[model samples]
Target: MIDSQSNNNHFISESGYLSSILRAPVYEVVQITPLQKMEKISLRFNNIILAKREDMQPVHSFKLRGAYSMISQLSIEEKKRGIVTASAGNHGQGVAFSAKKLGIKSLIVMPVVTTKIKIDAVHRMGGETYLFGSNFDESNKKAIEIAKKNNYIFIPPFDHPSIIAGQGTIAMELLQQDAHIDRIFVPVGGGGLVAGIIVFIKQLMPHIQVIGVEAEDSACLKAALLKGKPVSLSCVGLFAEGVAVKKIGLETFRLCKKYLDDIITVNNDSICSAIKDLFEDVRAISEPSGALALAGMKKYICKKKIKGEKLAHIVSGANVNFHSLRYISERCELGEKQEILLAVMIPEKKGSFLDFCKKIGKKIITELSYRYFHKENACILIGISLANRLNEKKKIIDNLIINKYKVIDLSKDEMAKLHIRYMIGGYPSKNILERLFSFEFPESPLALLKFLKNVSTYWNISLFHYRNYGTDYGRVLTAFHTTKNSPKFEECLNNLGYRFHEETNNPAFCFFLKK
Candidate 1:
């Protein structure tokens, strides 16, 4: 066992975390998860890629380590009072499982939009459940209030000393599992997991690089690093609900800033791709937030052009909602850059489609959408598969342009991917002055009703598109028919409390939907 008193390091001495982590009773409830080698990803990246299987824990997440550690250390009086916590999913399950093991009661407060799978898991683990708020932050406030009212001890998901030490136990097992690791990639939510890992790794194995990964839309850690403080984000993406934290915890930010080697942020597409990668390589279905570290590690290796180095990332959890797989399957190819979407202008005549196909050669067509829209010309949206993404895509586009066909790349267009492709048909018959906008709001029946009530009362809706991906947020593409060029419509949207982006001038909308 590592002794804190024998260590001369100032950080270890001041924090006393090395001893606390070593003495933590997390192993009683949590197992030493395996460090598995990712054979397929390793071969592709030309690096030794390993994954820490935190998803194998009883709660299907690393959260149990911290939850059990903190709860086990509670005084006798505190234990009798019970414990309360707000979680998106995994942490609540951990607390519930731990409390059951200790013969104590636990109350788990979750967001209204949380997946039924997680809520059910908590209940199965013996936790009394209360659904409240729309996201973690709001739920956390309610949990605190409930704890105060009921005289229960509040258990925070992150941001406490005992919790940090419990999570640090992973780093202890990691070094023991592999001695030649060049870098360790950890996912960041409120920064607890990454902070704990960094504190332990930097204090002991100072040479091994410790990197933090975060979802691009929920990158509170990166935002904090820039501003030199734990500033709150206005909104965070809910696709990766586990790590969709609006602000980094105060204690976590301090450790991350002081010892972390670097921070990397990944988009939702990359996260989807990473989930596919893990499933293909390890037969593990990881949640979006769970695969965040692998996505960041892949981006880092590609950016640095590093080869033959040993890299490892945490597979944090596997409690994904079953309905989310459809969205992930649709986006994984795009994230890998192995697929591209294009809008091509073809003459409105027979043999034009065949000629276009021949011009692009024998490449695989993943999707094609066409309709007779005009007498002179027609627009067709196409999806093509590419082995060499960058070069092949360029060649296909250049060949079409050389053949006198107007080609617009819709591969990177958000509107095209999320709405336009599915709703492709024809534009309005009359030349209507329409304003197109994309909006996102919390996913709930009440929230949707509230959104419609507010927007429909103010403007005449011309086009609307929405699909539920079993995520916490609802995405909608809508058009309002209006002759006024005033700021009143935008002002109304702002007051509606939904995130909106103007897509009226977007190329996809202009080519396919505008009259």
Candidate 2:
């Protein structure tokens, strides 16, 4: 059987794989996406930066190229027998669309957690969708089982030659678009896109650097390259869900090991910044996985101080759901180092709050939160905006410390930003009797405030913490001083009538918050 392993020493141009890719019949369904220059991004990096807009395709992704190419080359008997596959989102849509056009019936198995928008897109394209398990591997296993039982052809997302060749078509277009590109940054998921690009580039324009970018949370390619074989990841980051594969494909891994020049990983914040950069440069919003390549390119350029060279990045897809934009927008500034999170301590007295604000000066405050509890001291969470200079943050921190404002810089703390910032009460030192209550209350204006106000009237609220998780109901982890519970305490609970559970003996609360 032919595989990437057999093409070991032969350049891609001489390999039979290239001939197949060149003859791929994907043009019927796939568009030749534009390779456009990003002027704003180019200026920022002092280089000619370009983005290959794969998101511009009919499915708003590059997967259609591979999916259609693979299906079109199948034997007539294989088409009659139908096909089965698994995907996170893009590839499912690709297969569905291709199957519809080819008059072929296809069954797609997707993770139960796959985004609703993506599932709907696949359904619209005429693929039968089955939700199973919680990740790509789980769904893929189910797809294979169904394929085996029904005598159906199994279309592996990234492991087959036809898929790789179809994806390689993008590199073919890229070289024709800009023959002088210094490097190409491609995001690595199961590795189809990068492997395909490398196969095409290494054969012809071998001088151009082919770098692979991965989300630090799910760097399967980087892991495989290091270990010289594929390994299953215990857990993968879900922020960039499109690229969150537990294991790399065997064929894709082999091609990547032989062809890729380097691999780099970037944090979720860097990706958020890249999304913002794409919006600014091209007036286009890219999904987290799509912006990944640009993020890695920026990191490489900044670290190496590379200048005046042409760079290209594959903007892989634009299938981001509308709701996720809020989270991405909030983190982009922090990723760009234009925002800093801090915990500040000030006297819980009149005029102290104003004095703290005065120390911060005219710098804009991105976020601020404080609730008085009749204590000698109060800690508040604040986000400060900066002017994009590296020293601006340090200078502001220096000023705060000089004025004796107790401050903890949480700019570099991941947990602090993700979970701790919203839980700002910290460990309480009060001797008051506290009862922890976890509540599921309606997410509405004044719902939380009203609950707190009612409880505070009867018993001093020792601890209060809340962060919305984008659901109809908001979750609150709070503690009330029930030392001197009166008739009003029970009255408050009945008045709110929200679902809640007391955690007086919960080990987590006892260990972390109990005084």
Q: Pick by lDDT: which candidate is best?
A: 1
**Pairs that collide, model 2:** none
Tens digit per residue, CA lDDT, model 1, 1-515: 22211112224442588888889999998999999999999999999999999999999999999899888988778889999999999999999999999989999999988877888899999999999987899999999899889988888898876788899999999999997899999999998899889889988888999999999899999999999999999998889988999999887888889999998999988999999999999999999999999999999999889799999999999999889999999999999999999999999988988888888778899999998889999999999999996599899899899899999999888889999999887688799999999988677778778877877886889998998887777789989998777568777888887788999999999999998
Cα error, candidate 1, residue 78 (Å): 0.3
What lDDT is reached at residue 11 by model 1?
A: 44
State residue 343's C-alpha deviation in candidate 2, in Å: 0.6
Instruction: Show the lowest summed lDDT stretch of 10 residues, model 1.
Output: 1-10
RMSD values for the candidates in order, in angstroms, are 3.3, 8.0
Tens-digit lDDT string for candidate 2 (224-291): 87888999887776778778888898878888898899988999899999999999989888989999
